[model samples]
Target: MKILLVLDNLSSSCGANVGIVYELARTWVERGHEVYCLTRKDRFHDIDQQKAGLLHMVWSFDVTEDDILNNVTKSDKWIHLSATGKAIFELTHPVFLQKMIDKKFCESSEIRNEYRKQIEKLFKERSFDAAVAVTEPFYIADALASAKVDTDKYVIMMDPYTNNPSTTDRTRKKKLAREQHVFESARKVFTLDFVGNDMNYLSEELLGKRVNFCVPKVKKCGAGRSDDGATVVDSEKIDFVYVGQLYEDIRNPELMLKIFTRLPDNYILHFYGGGCEQIVDKYKEILGDRLVIHGWVSSDESALAQQNAHILINMNNSIKNMLPSKLIEYINTGKPILNICQIQDCPSIPYIQKYPMAVNIMPMDNDNNIVTAMISDRDLETMAMEVQAFTENYQGKIVEHDVIENIYSDCISENVADMMLEEMQK
Candidate 1:
């Protein structure tokens, strides 16, 4: 069976879309099925294309800053001749929308039309047994619809459209229309987390569509070096680490800075990844020698950094269900988990809290209480043991491979159905 995976920016490691595509495709390839990645040509699009061992095709479209700002209207009156052209221009080109909210440009008709045109052209040459459309937004769904794919299509829903508080008014309308199309048109819907049920409610209210939920597999890092040859700092001189975007809204790295700064001189904090560099720089100025901001470590190096750290920190203010894909890699490393974000009601949160090595922190004084629960020596010892146990369990876990293999098996089973249906005509 051939499976087609479609996404806008398919190369991003930080984004959920690429993570799902890579994990699913890796599993599909291992199971001996052909996998194709269809995405728009963009900055990060080429990064993992070859690594995935999947066919890569890009829709011919380039969105520049000039196209985003609706500046075309200022230069040429012809673009405003019809509402469709204006709306299409505004939706596909997102320079203006970013000014409103740091949002993606997949809402535009121009982008959708390009996706549709390219996909249709590809379909004329190659047919797929099944397709998985990830991150249901307006333009992607519209493109799928324009390509006229049938009801057996599957779409992985991340968060519903309304949950994005930063959505622009124009984007909101376009999102509503496209989301409706996805729910009504796609054969099935799979959500990474439990948020899809909420999305289904919104979908039924807006588009009269029903959605299904499936737990997406958590990802593990490519194996890292054992700490054998690495210099093991004395227990008192251990380092803690935090990786990924650090900003005020989702991850308050500032708060982490305050807590780690107050720690005795023996402790160190290594910061990796990009975004809010100034914020991190401010901490480096204050914490000086205690804090090291490495800024954007390579994938392999970052995994090594996680292994070297005495403790690895993962925190986010997004809804509890908003699991950072990196957390899975963090878990696989078997380091002590210091989770700053906690929700008692979320399904996954309970498992994390149950881990004897996990420290679930909540605000004790104000909105973000810098003071976290005490990390006693006994707790650290227990955590170290848990880390060892976790690493062993995750080391080449057949279950992770199994989940993906099952999804591929499900995809290939359709080939059997196709054969059965053809035989029935006999």
Candidate 2:
């Protein structure tokens, strides 16, 4: 069997989507199937280099950052008339610029034509048995749909539809129409989380079939090790680690700041990913050295940090429908988790509850009101105590590598690959 995966970016390490794509390609290659990946030329080269053997072909377009930027500005002009459009431009103009830039580039007719021509060339080289289009930027899938590829095409929707703050009603309608077109054109649609169930209704309305659900899995990057060659459990400070971006709206760290500042001196909060500069700057005086910011580290370094930390922290405030990919990595560490999720029915709640060492705290004041009625100091102290107790309970217990592997294996890419193969056969 031959498979083609279309994506925007494929980083060398530390992304759940990239990990899934690599694992799927790996699984197919191990099974003697041919796998080809097509992404933008500007994507991290290390990813393609690292998986050279597994991927039969790693094709990239001549699209550059400047090209994407220029296209984004052109696209922005189309939406400039509306208040939402102006707000979207201002909010994401420079800081969160990738979202709009990628969207515009993907939706460009000229770009799609170029992609279609290249895809046609590839199709001429070898007949692809199936193609998986990850829905984001939504351009590759749209291009594939327009090209009328004969193979079994599958669309994987990783995120639910949220009304874009910067989009006009007309733009929103067009986006939805394009998504519906992609869904209607696919052999089958798949989602990484149960939140896609809500999209099932839309799929049924458009294509008379519901979307399928699959668990998003992470690759077993080896456990993180300390420089001094000692286990994290033996460390003097009780490390509470958080990895990934700290978007102000979605996954805010303000409440965590409130809790961390009040914690005992022995307890330190370490941030491993980017996008928390504002929070770090605001609390720099009070946090002092207790808050350690490691900016962005390699995948190995992140795994090592997770392995060393006394507790893994997840902050899911108000963001619904998507599961945090970092949770899989945290679980792999076999350390106690401190999940502060305000959403009552967050999909991660059940998983956290399943793990004995994990503590899920849904603060009473979780509404959009961040200023008023925040997580009280009393509750913060109580939660800190609970976290300490949870950590102490698993201090000496060694969770074998195999145990962690088994937990992740259930959702491994092999399972998803096999499922896709079965769907293709049908």
Candidate 3:
């Protein structure tokens, strides 16, 4: 069985799209399926390095940075854009800059052609049984879909590219024809979150093409439990660690900022991710060293931090359809998780509710009074106490048993491998 996966990074800590596909690809390899990958040169992970010799073949797209300090910003590897195009990107809000940077990269012909050639080369080497194209960068999917490979091609959209509310109408118009081709080229399409799955009608309406997007429940992670001694675990303190980007208006850290101060001084909150500039001082001023801010970390470093933390924190976007990518890593940690939902039906609730050591704090609910927004002092205090109680009482970790074992094998990856074997048998 031969399967080809297209994504940004194979690193679990890179984000959701990569992590989900990595677990799926890993399982297929362990089952003796031949798996190949095309990813960003800089975004490759060490986990795959250990498995590279016999397990798989990886063709990284190209270097996105001189060094990884470019990190999520992508400022170093950016080329081909006109001077004005680059200047306009500088003015984009820091919260949204990383995303726009990605869009800009996807707009590059040079990068796209390089990926197309590699995709063609791989297909030329052997006809793949299945081609799974994942997207945060929609162009990669476009490249994969546009390929002349005879395999059953599929597209996994971790984000709603044409329908993203943050994007302007002009951008959507520019991308619609291109993305419709990608979706139409695939045998099936998948979205990571169910909310997005429900919005397939919206995508179809926008694309002017038939589209059926299903949510694949591949949330289990096989990586990210390694403790490299990178984090200094304080046995005397209770630490609630949050990893991922922060937004000023959208994914604001106001709730996390308020909650930990209510706990005893021994309870601390550590933040790890980008877009921390606006609140770094505020974190110091309000919590005064109790809420530690770790601005940016490598994928390996991010894993170690989560492995060492007493509690993991996750926040859902208000869009309702967009789920946080960090939830996968948080679940993998097996640590008690404190998930703050910004809306009533936050997409992460279903997954969080299933975990034995997880709790959800939403904006409003009859059963829970957990919103940090303009609630009375009493409600705020009660919420704070509830967090402490939940944190202290959980003794069990979320182990491998919590995952749906047959999901990948019974669904996409396994189906791909089996169909190929069936064809060979014929």
Cα lDDT, all candidates: 0.55, 0.66, 0.64
lDDT per residue as tens, model 3, 1-426: 777787766553556566556655666677788888777665444335653444467776555432332443444334335568766756754634544455454475545666677788878877777887888777788888777777888776778776665657667666767767786787666555453554443465443432333233233334334423223446588777888987765677777676666788888888788663556566678788787878778777887787778778897676566777677556655577888877776778777776667788753442333334675567567778888888767623444523433322332334443443444334
Model 2 residue 236 lDDT score: 70
- C-alpha lDDT of residue 318 in model 2: 60
Model 2 gets an lDDT of 0.66
Ranking by TM-score: 2, 3, 1
How large is the C-alpha RMSD of every model relative to the true structure? Answer: 9.5, 5.6, 6.7
Q: Native-vs-model 1 lDDT?
A: 0.55
Better of 1 and 3 by lDDT: 3
Rank order by lDDT, top first? 2, 3, 1
| Error in Å for residue 132 of model 3 | 2.0
Error of 2 at 196 (Å): 1.6
What residue pairs are clashing in model 2? 84-166, 224-304
Using TM-score, give the best candidate's number: 2
Worst 10 residues of 1 by lDDT: 395-404
